[model samples]
Target chain A: MTGPHGYSKDKDAHLKRLRRIEGQIRGLQRMVEEDVYCIDILTQVSASTKALQSFALQLLEEHLRHCVAHAVERGGPEVDAKVAEATAAIARLLRT
Target chain B: MTGPHGYSKDKDAHLKRLRRIEGQIRGLQRMVEEDVYCIDILTQVSASTKALQSFALQLLEEHLRHCVAHAVERGGPEVDAKVAEATAAIARLLRT
Candidate 1:
């Protein structure tokens, strides 16, 4: 909901990663279709989940380096808001 | 890889869920393309992660209900192997 977000500069790379993860999800579908072993499917799920966490971490790093830091430089309540937001995001990630 | 695996009976449902998740991944790509807020994107990532976990949970349920149960009924070392295999899978899921 914001323009030129922290990840905007790397949008293409982000899309590429998302697409690759999408492919992994499709691979999981195929594994199910072919009746692959349960453990094998579970392993793929974990891989996809791990890939997603990595993407989140990267986005978070950029957010802190850019958006959050920018908020701090602006010298207002925005910095607190950004830090709280990032913390919430991190908590959601950890729970997942 | 083994079939008819525990999930084979519900193959269609599993495939459908995975396709939905794939769509979510595509949605994430669109968000990045549109330069959505970093936190918003992170929220969606958590959602996708949660969905994957749900799918894994369902698969595990079927695995325990069918595969593990079958193994137990057969009354061999298979029961031990299946239980151990499932425990390992759960550990992996927890780590993710």
Candidate 2:
């Protein structure tokens, strides 16, 4: 299902964060092109990874607060399914 | 310390991957802009995160195969320091 989903409320903020991350990724490319130190590049990679994770966490929080909460209020099998889906997504985040 | 590190050998490949990741991040921005589903966005985030980690692993492999190995071949406290530094980087990767 497409959206206007749970994260729609923070869409601007999320887009801004993603753009910043995009810039960071571009910076890494420049580092590679310029032959920057490996350790420094690796450090930047870590920072980028962390930024992606942080963004995911924010979106997930909103999903739980909105989508999952609504499903829970309805009190049906869909609630269980929504919760499970959310959990699986969290697992994916952790695995990375 | 910069310019022509171990990863320089694969500089083109690394730059290619980083550029792809930058594209992915931009895709994410478009997704957010279009208001794609929360779960779908999260999935993309995981993919991007995995891609970053994969790039990092490749870099680390080269670093160990060349830089760290060189330090060990030198036979001194430099070897120990290099290993420690590498281990610390690994730790940072894990925590993220």
Candidate 3:
């Protein structure tokens, strides 16, 4: 059976957020397709961008706790590599 | 014991790719700081965008195989939720 860290818990919450984001994305798509004002499209784009960044941050947190921590327990160069890689990914997400 | 699906596997390669992308990101930052031409910055931005897209694609593949597939096996509404969530994430990544 799966525990809290087993990717089962919290999935429903994630899905709801994703569905909302999906709606936002479709709205953006329609904005582009319908030749909306440039500033309006840009504003929607910025909102969508923030939504995606937030989502990435959430995923990064889960990955760090469940994936990276689990990998570190194995004790090897690979653990260090994963830490570095995940950190870099987080940094990249923050940079954008 | 860790198996092939464990996060440890393939980490080093991901780190190396991340480091290269980090260097590219830093370069972009420098360009912005130096007030480089707008087009030049935009071009670098596009490159970095593509790099991120590629990295996200790779991570999505791993997440699908290890995370989503594993979640599906446990059998619950949560499992379907996770699959839908991950699929939605991949779709968003592709859209951008």
What's model 2's overall lDDT? 0.92
TM-score of chain A of each: 0.95, 0.97, 0.76
lDDT of 2 by residue, A1-96 (tens): 767788898888999999999999999999999988788888999999999999999999999998999888999899989989999999999899
Fraction of native Cα contacts kept in each candidate? 0.96, 0.89, 0.00
Sorted by DockQ, highest first, which candidate order results? 2, 1, 3
**Superposition-based RMSD of candidate 1 using all C-alpha atoms, in angstroms:** 1.1
Better candidate number, 1 or 2, judged by TM-score: 2
Candidates arranged by TM-score, highest first = 2, 1, 3
Q: Which one is best on TM-score?
A: 2
Decide which is better by lDDT, 2 or 3.
2
Query: Of the candidates shown, which would achieve the greatest DockQ relative to the real structure?
Result: 2
In the order shown, the candidates' DockQ scores are: 0.85, 0.87, 0.05
- What are the runs in model 2 whose C-alpha is more than 4 Å off? none
RMSD of 3: 11.5
TM-score (C-alpha) between model 1 and the true structure: 0.96
How would you encode candidate 3's per-residue C-alpha lDDT over B1-96 as one tens digit per residue? 245663448889888888989999999889989999999999998888877777765676566545654554454675546645754564465345
Candidate RMSDs in Å, in order, are 1.1, 1.0, 11.5
Better of 1 and 3 by DockQ: 1
* CA displacement after TM-score superposition, residue B62 of candidate 1 (Å): 0.6
